[model samples]
Target: MPAAHHPDLELDDIQAGALAERPSPYVGKYLLLRITDRADGRELVRRLHRIATASRTSERTDDTTLTVAFSYHGLEALGVPQTSLDSFAPEFREGMAARAAVLGDVGESSPEHWEAPLGSTDVHVAIAALSPDAARLEAAAEQARRAHAELPGLEVVWRQDCYQLVTGRTSFGFRDGIGQPAVEGSGRPSTNPREPSLKAGEIILGYPDETGELPPMPMPEVLGRNGTYVVFRKLHTKVAAYRNYLRDRASNREDEELLGAKMVGRWQSGAPLVLAPDRDDPELGADPQRNNDFLYAEDARGFKCPVGAHARRANPRDSLYQDGSVDVRLHRMIRRGTSYGPMLPPGELEDDGEDRGIIFVFAGAHLKRQFEFVKTQWLNDGIFIGAPEERDPLVGPNDESSGFTIPQRPIRRKLQNLPPFVVTRGGEYLFAPGLNAMRWLSELDT
Candidate 1:
């Protein structure tokens, strides 16, 4: 195998949110907007164009970034040509809500049960601002406010403020934002030495993906090049319930932590089971060079990292490649998550009734293949791993009937009567256009 030839990416025009690794200890905000007038929407785009940070830049002393995206209805509301609108990926055109069933959003997770303005047609625009501190975050927010503040035609319908928990982990107590793939031309290096750089087209449009072909882009090169689909999902975690479940299943305190690590495939300290199979290694977990460096080839039976564990099912790296029927690389997508609400007090077993979880952000070119495929085939179901009755132990919409199996020495250990630990509050699929596309949209003739 040869090293991939990196493309001359248009970093200056690409949104920083698409490629830039989020800074740790960060504060951010997510805003959902409804576009009432086409002219005002276009004006909003024009204003945001000036503030949306580019992927490659040296002007900022403070690490603050602004990103703007439009939903399918948003493009139409902004008066985008019908032909162009029809040319986008069908999954993006139909919107995430329309495909809820495929994403396992049944029962309480269904769109009808979703939060207001999230899955509705009223959600036209989605803007996100992220920074390392409160002051920088506020500065970015003000810029976004100015973009649509005076525009009576554009109304801010919903806002959710998110930040890194003091423990620098998700509400469930695992270090996250790890295992992000390196985009070939993005200049960011992969944390895992075993992982190869993904083709730029896998994330941004108009570039060759893993298939060695340019993915289908929306009509008109200017509107599609350097752009990508963004998937935003709000998940609510039942921290107290999760803690209680582990406590009930384990023999003692050490076994309780081990059970959690088995489910997540990584200890709370971020140490992977593949590397530190017997114990949690905080030192190894903190070292970026070693934490994400292992593959699942030797653990084909998943004794080290359970096949149905949340992290393993989410990536699976080389585990599925042996069968030749599946290629994990095709489904790979960049995932970024930020915790919202306050963390529950440690070791508390009772429900606090406070809202807290993670806001998941995904960036990729192929929505159906990348994001949706993983959600449907990998996490929600376990057929690919030969465990049809199982789902991801942590985030999957598990029920009393759902069970998780851990490969062990004498025999397999099955944990049954699993309860749903996470619920989908809301979600949206938006198109993040490049700077040139932003300009093209701003100059569109309604």
Candidate 2:
């Protein structure tokens, strides 16, 4: 069935950066700021309100862009009324740091080991600048810098430079930014024909969600309408270790590539294993129309794309429909990822101390049901699929006891003793308010 269309959405008041699809081969940066002085902070927001573009404009242009969001503490620092603060979702108020254990951020991925100021209360506001090239990226960054140039109360606490690898792959050597859910009435087409555009409330507040009910929003109708929750995470990828593990398991070069594809459920070219089960089809991968148009209903047995693969776990599609009780749309989110740090020298199996990984950003209305549910239920546990001990093979926080199973002919092949391939550097939960909401913040008397 086609998604219910919402024609009356307030696109003009929504931040373009929140719904705009990033350009290919882009350059970007994340700036974490602390508001030491409330008055100056309001002034910063006022300037930013003028600089941030609306989604209506952002969708049409391929130029540099700026996005602004505030953490829970940020709103409190800026003097948002107590009742208004309490109106927000509890998950957002407690923040990502407090929910670390629920997110499987244990062992090396725990909050104690996270980079300073990321999970800390000091991170007030987040500014992201993205552009198609270096010059444009700098142009966007300059615009952001000018927003608070004279504000002594606001300080840039942390910054991470990010870009798309020339090959358009992450540190893990596989294509990223695939399968983003399209928001209803956003003037954007769904990448997957099998997946309908999500109801507006699934991502933006104040609209009826899949259940035909309005998702909870922050207090004050103007403050929450058209606003969305944001999830920012820094994941450090262990490239060499991933390569070494596959190398030791596979029989030959081709087998090594297949093994990696099986783990991710997609070839490095972005071709899904379910569609190109035996070999990769680069042309198919390059074509967005065909690449994501597949569903897992045909591969129920996991002979093609393993049920435990990272991509499959991230999005089960129709694979879980047999239960009839679950609606996949409720757990969907808008996921965007950009690579940071230089790509590890290709074909090198030895560990290099350089830090390289992906800066993952998620936009959704229901943080717990959409983002957190997927992380804890789908990616970290396998009970839904009948395998209780498994997690996502490629990115799961697996220890020596972790394993992945690939179902095949005579006997199923299982890879044992999987090590953790990705680690959480840090993260935060923020609220990206509508443009008018931002204006409200700037003019706040409280």
Candidate 3:
């Protein structure tokens, strides 16, 4: 397979493999730095100006390249007119042109517009090291933290969240990071041996319209585009709350192990419920060929996996694929998140207290089309599989009026009585830009 290339960015073997490693892409030691106020925006630009002009030019470090995906807040706070901000901020454009005269061989600039909610103004900054180095990452994070402190208008919402290939927990607690779409032309044999030649937009965005275009944007403009919409969520799972719920649901025959498997859709090992419904299939989970191959076809109608199973609703494998011909690729998202806080204490299983959960990060072309749509329409909405009483049993919101319930079916046995397991704490939306765009922003005037 050839390498997947955008006009401004490239996904080489290393990058693509890292991205395809798990359910989520590998974001490395990156921080979702947010700037909330206009005054902070001005101060930020001023410091960037000083750094750009005074700092001696040096070879790029594993930590040197900082890519950002700014929300409209950053742009509006910077006072970018709506007309020019989409194409290129006029001030940034001019600054780049002036810098080009002094800094020869500066890379070409390619800016793309992304969809935003009607009244959003928060800017998202995604800063990552070009290469992974612990010391450098610490320094970079410190620099970002200090920068935030210096600017009175900006407030750091979430801090020090790492991006991983797989999101830590399923509804069940197995190592659930495996099988993702291979970037087209990346020299990687598709995990699904049958589907060899997949298109870029299929996984990145939904299928194009009659003209083969994505909604709200031209195909050329969206295809190979650098910026992708990312939803960042802080989910706080009450370990005690979850454990007590499991214990209450477990009848005389069911054990703690069985109960945990049902809740997470897998066991401590990374097996799937569809394959090893009765027990943990460590061998199957380890096998690359068999792990991601099962579809919710038999499971779709609630025969094999439940209607609200995490993996089932997440991709649905072949369940939603019409005729096994039409690819429901748009539903896919690159989940690049990591687990935060510490493991739950042994005796605290019954305590109704605070505990941490996964920091959810999903990236795709359109928020409405991909991330939000999945959360609102399928995951949180139990109607996808025609089950009025089921939502994503694990992450589904708790509201009796809304008809969502967490069913506790032990291992292979079908039991309907269960309660909610996960709860939302806080979250936000962000955008991630390419390397060149970050440099351009630095040179711009406030």
Candidate 4:
């Protein structure tokens, strides 16, 4: 039997899964799995369906919890009909390895060069866990272990622990997880009031998107409804290298910090350069609503927030409003990242041989328009803003030819031969299905 598709979807029926999930002031862990037993895989899906109530509740979940997502292959492994898998987005179907170069996953970032556990094709499931305390985290881990035990075919291959920093900043000491889009009807409050609110379909599948079109859904309607695509990239940040570059290019410690801010277009406190161009404003960064309120309308000339800055490129809010060449709303994504390694102490310019970086996760209804388009067109290219050969100062390719240019009054200053400070250790494109969809997968004919 084939699953029937529906053209429209309701909001209340959607799962409170990862797309709109908010950050919690606690520690987190991610368990990546690979399926080995075909029959047992569906049994695992059944087990997950049994706890569907406990799952997909909220991102700011209470202590001892986990959220689940599966790759296109994961569903196929569990005997999902080929038709259901075929209806998913192309990128989701092809997987991340095939699109690595377009995503700037070349060189050290390539999956072929990743650690054994990450590069393998056996990767299937992703479980995200969060807790208020370590004891609680361990208890949750035990619970997760017991749950996995329900499916003998499920194998946990890779595990990474992500913790919330006290300063609410990434390993680079800059505030992240800000400037995310607010999906309409997702129940999550908007962070930036002035930034446009995207349609529910833009972030959640089955709803009408910004273009007034509902994205394509998998068969049976139930499996595809309330689902969204996710791109999970584990980025290893070279903290000392980044700090050294800033230090060397700057005249003093203050200048170094300011230079870093210029690279990211935000102060360590989360203040946007367009608002506080000359200094760090902790007060502005503290306000969730006000911090992201400013836009690139008045700063289009690259004087305030350098058109090539990482943050500006990632989300060129008002800058493209007049251009009409690209629709920013259609490309908006829900970005959530957590640092995985130990935090390098402030003012420490030396490397401690510790593995520390961010686990970057982006969720959206349209993977190509939102995540892929942003990565290739915005983050990797400078032509949209005026600089043709320039790359993002913070995380761009930074190859020998890649450099960053800052527009100034006297004369433009260009930093040449910038080295990449971030490496894509591992990543994948996943389908985060609704709770009912989980049930559909469990009930599918085996």
Best by lDDT: 2
Lowest lDDT 10-residue stretch of candidate 1: 1-10
> Candidate 1 on 1-446: residue-level lDDT in tens?
21122366788878888898777889999999999988999999998887774323657756678888999999999989999999999989898899998899988889999999888899999999999999989988988998898899999999999998545698899999778899998888889989999989899988889999789998788899889999999999999999999999999999999999999999999999999999999998878888999999999998899988999999999988886988899999999989999899888899988999999999999999999999989999989989888998888989879999999999988999899999999999999998889988989996
lDDT of each: 0.89, 0.91, 0.49, 0.79
Model 4's TM-score against the true structure: 0.94
- TM-score for all models, in order of appearance: 0.97, 0.97, 0.69, 0.94
Once model 1 is optimally superposed onto the true structure by TM-score, how far is the C-alpha of residue 43 displaced, in angstroms? 0.7
- What residue runs in model 4 are displaced by over 4 Å at the alpha carbon? 1-13, 55-65
Which regions of candidate 1 deviate over 4 angstroms? Answer: 1-6, 53-58
> lDDT order of candidates, best first?
2, 1, 4, 3
Residues 318-377 of candidate 4 have per-residue lDDT tens digits of 789895778788888888888898999988989999989989888888889889988888
Instruction: Write down the lDDT that model 2 would get.
Output: 0.91
Q: What are the clashing pairs of model 1?
A: none
**Model 2 stretches with alpha carbons more than 4 Å out:** 1-7, 53-60
